[model samples]
Target: MTAPTTSRAARAALVLALLVTGLSMRTAVTSVGAVLDDLQDDLHASGGAAGLITTMPVLCFAAFGAATPRLARALGPHRLLVVALAVTTVGLATRPFAGGVALFVVVSTAALAGSAVSNVLMPSLVKLHFPDRIGTMTALYTTALAVGVTAAAGLTVPIGEAGDGWRQGLAAWAVVSAVAVVPWLPTVAADRRARATTLAGPVAPTGPDAAGSAAPPARAVPMSALLRSRTAWALTVFFGTQSMQAYITFGWFARFLTDHGIESGTAGAMLAVLTALSIPVSLVVPRIPARHHRAVVGLFVVCLATAYVLMAAAPRPTAWIWVVLAGVGGGSFPLLLTLLGMRARTADTIATLSAFVQAIGYLIAGTGPLLFGALYGVTGSWALPIAVLFTALGVMTVASRRSTTPRFVDDELAASPR
Candidate 1:
């Protein structure tokens, strides 16, 4: 089915909303990594507490993202996103003022909570508004996401150094989140009008019955039924493992470089390079035909595994090389995001599948940084953390074998006897 007829202004507003929302999502998480040491020093946080800070994003995302479908159904996606962005702005602006480690985590969780909702809703919004243009829209927003990740990683240290400290750098993102809320506000009104139009219009179901009359409305697949599908499970594993690697990269890659005797600013720059590469890769990867996804996934796994080995073994001497490899591997993120749209037919199904994938995927991702920090605290090195990434890559490889196949959740549900 085509998107509901929208005024040009409404379309423009939606595009801006998607771009800025993508830009705002990662700043809360990545900004901290560049100034982590100073923040830890100020808070007098232990290594375990520091690990928890990095882990908080995924934890909050898992918790809040699971509820987004329900929230969107009741409030509408655009209106809910306006609330999410406002919460994000408030959380980002205030968290920097928290006095101790615990308060900081609490406030940061609030910020991540907002990001979590935005993250899950983006795919559903794209599917709803641009059903035939999924690849293009996914690339546009994911590229914007990469830009945000790169800017936050590369500039945070310098921003911190220029101001009072890490607080200034971290809080600066609140302004961007505030700006993102504007586009969404207009879209909320547009959404109401669109819904009214949909309700008032005649229902022309897509297919007919054997007697040649119009068919009934397609039923949305429930989340519980997804648990029984191998494809859903595989996609979940694929998304989880890739996110684990990504969170590790954002949370610790800068610190890893600094620990290896690289300057902090240079380390942040390397991390920036890693994220910046994803912009182009995100654009290109989503456009690649699904037939090539397995080969692409294999290539990404190789680059990621090799980067981990190099970083663990000889981080300083060839750090840039590792960053390049890892950045290329990070393309898997956009790949999986594209699949969220591809694997489902209707927007409702996309929302359900997207939530199912991200909610659980992030739970699995949350463990990466926590375990990375725990092992580094215990072993006094990065080797074990890198080893854990290697193990995740293996799991991702196995999972992608089924996930990358061309299939739809709607079809799977129709075939199920239950």
Candidate 2:
């Protein structure tokens, strides 16, 4: 079915809401990491215990995101996202008061679940609301997400100074999430109307005959078909590998720099630069036409390889060079997100494929740091893990090429003889 055209103002409003929603999603997790050292000192937690705090977002993302589509199907995306924002707000605000690690983890898990739902749903939201402007909207929200993370990391410590310490600093993001929910009130109203219409009668269920008359758009491709597609598996693996690299870099890059004799403050600044660099690249890459994906991804991979080589050979003096190259390599994060929409024809497919990719992908990703960290512990050198990252990037480049090929997920599934 043809999508109803939204007025420019309404479209702009939706984009604003999406930007706020995207901002709300990542800050809760990153802010926690910004203050992790303080939390560890306060709780007297072991390195493993402290690491879990940073890592919990990935676990919650995979677990909760695996189930988000089911929830979105039942509640509808806008209403569900509103509920997610509410949960995120409550979780962030309340976790600071938890006096111990166990309670903190529980509350943080709850918060991250909310963020996970938002993360998985954003692409589908973009698909549904801004089909014609997928690249633009994706870039806008991605840019906001990048800025949100940078701001939280840069400012949280100063914010925390007004209160007891890191706990209060961490809790400050509750304001961001809380404020984000405001723009969604209009969206929730619209979702209620749509849900009402959907429930009012037989809902004009779609069929093979949908194109001729009053059948709903051909029943959304079953998730089962998506599961059978070679394209789907390739994209999912691509997403997983990129996420593994992303999570590892976010969680451990600073420590690696410090270990190499950089001061902690300078290391943190370098890591921030790596993250900040992704913002412009994220905005620009998605806006490029599909034909160029291979060249773009190829260049970024080459840059990443160069960075890895530098780190292995002359990590200290050339650290800036490595940081810049590594940031571009990580551009795959947004590029993959853009493909989720660019790839799927129907909003249902976008939503389901997103849930499937991220759910499975993050579970795979969540293991990267632990596995590599364990390898480091056993071998006592950075070479082994760096080599492992090289292997992941090699495989990721292959999968990314397959995912970027100009084919729609729905088209692939429909062409199946089965």
Candidate 3:
């Protein structure tokens, strides 16, 4: 290939790397969820075992997500992602064949661990490769991520029914995970070239020209320094609250709808609508300029709070409206991904912040469904849980508004006391 065509081919490969990796990130979680009942029956698992399976995504995301930055430093982000995809493929392909629930959970955890690391790496990879088009690239990848979540949720059951069992259904996603690895192999080669470039010269690669042309610069700020940065804290809180809201909706919203007198089938459809709406919202939110992010955050807060209020006050009559509003509010996730790029200058900073934000943020998120379930169990009414979630929206709004302000975590880290 000519130099120009070779560069174009490399760029195309990187884009595919982002899109497919995002598409695979949630497949391990949602495919199992789609066939949870069948899988539980086949494995003869108890309710608690099943619950642990359902909860593993956030738990794995928190623990492994925190470890990803260090892993990336050692592996190089591109090579680490190739390893992650390999792990994902193996875990997905194997978990379905386990004879017992214990083995199933173990392999499933492996799959989620891979997905978790991939999740943390995305923002940094985008920052490294497509720095000039963060908005567009983020929109593309997150939209793909949303599609993966929706497709796995919507299709796994039918595939299960058509095949040998839930095992076949869950294992089928391994194909997609394996395909996601292809683009990254070439990208790892690019990383090698980048490292060679760094070794051959005194001047370092920086900015958009550095895309796949140099290794990410060494970290200027230690991860511990983030503890003292207000911007980092604000982003963490914002990410946590939004993630909590999303997990609660996915985990409990169907029951919440059914409890409010909607038919079970309709409630399931509404939940699908809520999940599917994230695709378009993900596409749109990133295109909004940073100048208007505060307003965008306010709009999401209003949509979410309104959805909660309507669900609490007039759920059955306005169920569709609530779904639509909540769907719009789900844009918070894509918006946060965009902010992950905006809040850091260098690829290294983005990687650090992404890890810090998603690690503790996911731990915070993991509590929402449990807390919501507990509150409802205690009160025997959705009122208490809805009210609590409404309060969380308030917190998310404050944090998101603060984090959306034009500030870099790197600058804040520099100013923080050692």
List model 1 lDDT by residue over 1-418, tens digit each. 2255788888887788888988998999889876888899999999889878876777788889888877776676777788999999999999999999999988898899899988888887887776666777888899989889888877777777899878998999999899999877766775565542111111222211112233235454557778867778888999999888887887788788888889988886787777789989988997777678889999998998888888777888989999999999989999899888777656766777888898899889878877987899999977788898898889999999888887776666667787
- After superposition, the stretches of candidate 3 with alpha carbons farther than 4 Å from their true spots are 1-6, 193-220
Q: Give the runs in model 2 whose Cα sits over 4 Å from its true position.
A: 1-5, 196-216
Tens digit of per-residue lDDT, candidate 2, span 277-320: 98888789878777788898998899989998998999999999
Candidate 2: TM-score? 0.92
What would the per-residue lDDT of candidate 3 be over residues 177-220, giving only the tens digit for each residue? 99999988866765554552111111233333233333323454
Clashes of 2: 0
In candidate 3, the residue pairs with backbone N, CA or C atoms under 3 Å apart (3 or more residues apart, or in different chains) clash, namely none
RMSD of each: 4.3, 4.1, 4.1
Candidate 3 lDDT at 24 equals: 93
- Model 3 scores a TM of 0.93
Runs in model 1 lying further than 4 Å from the true structure: 1-3, 44-46, 160-163, 190-221, 254-266, 308-318, 373-384
TM-scores for all predictions: 0.87, 0.92, 0.93
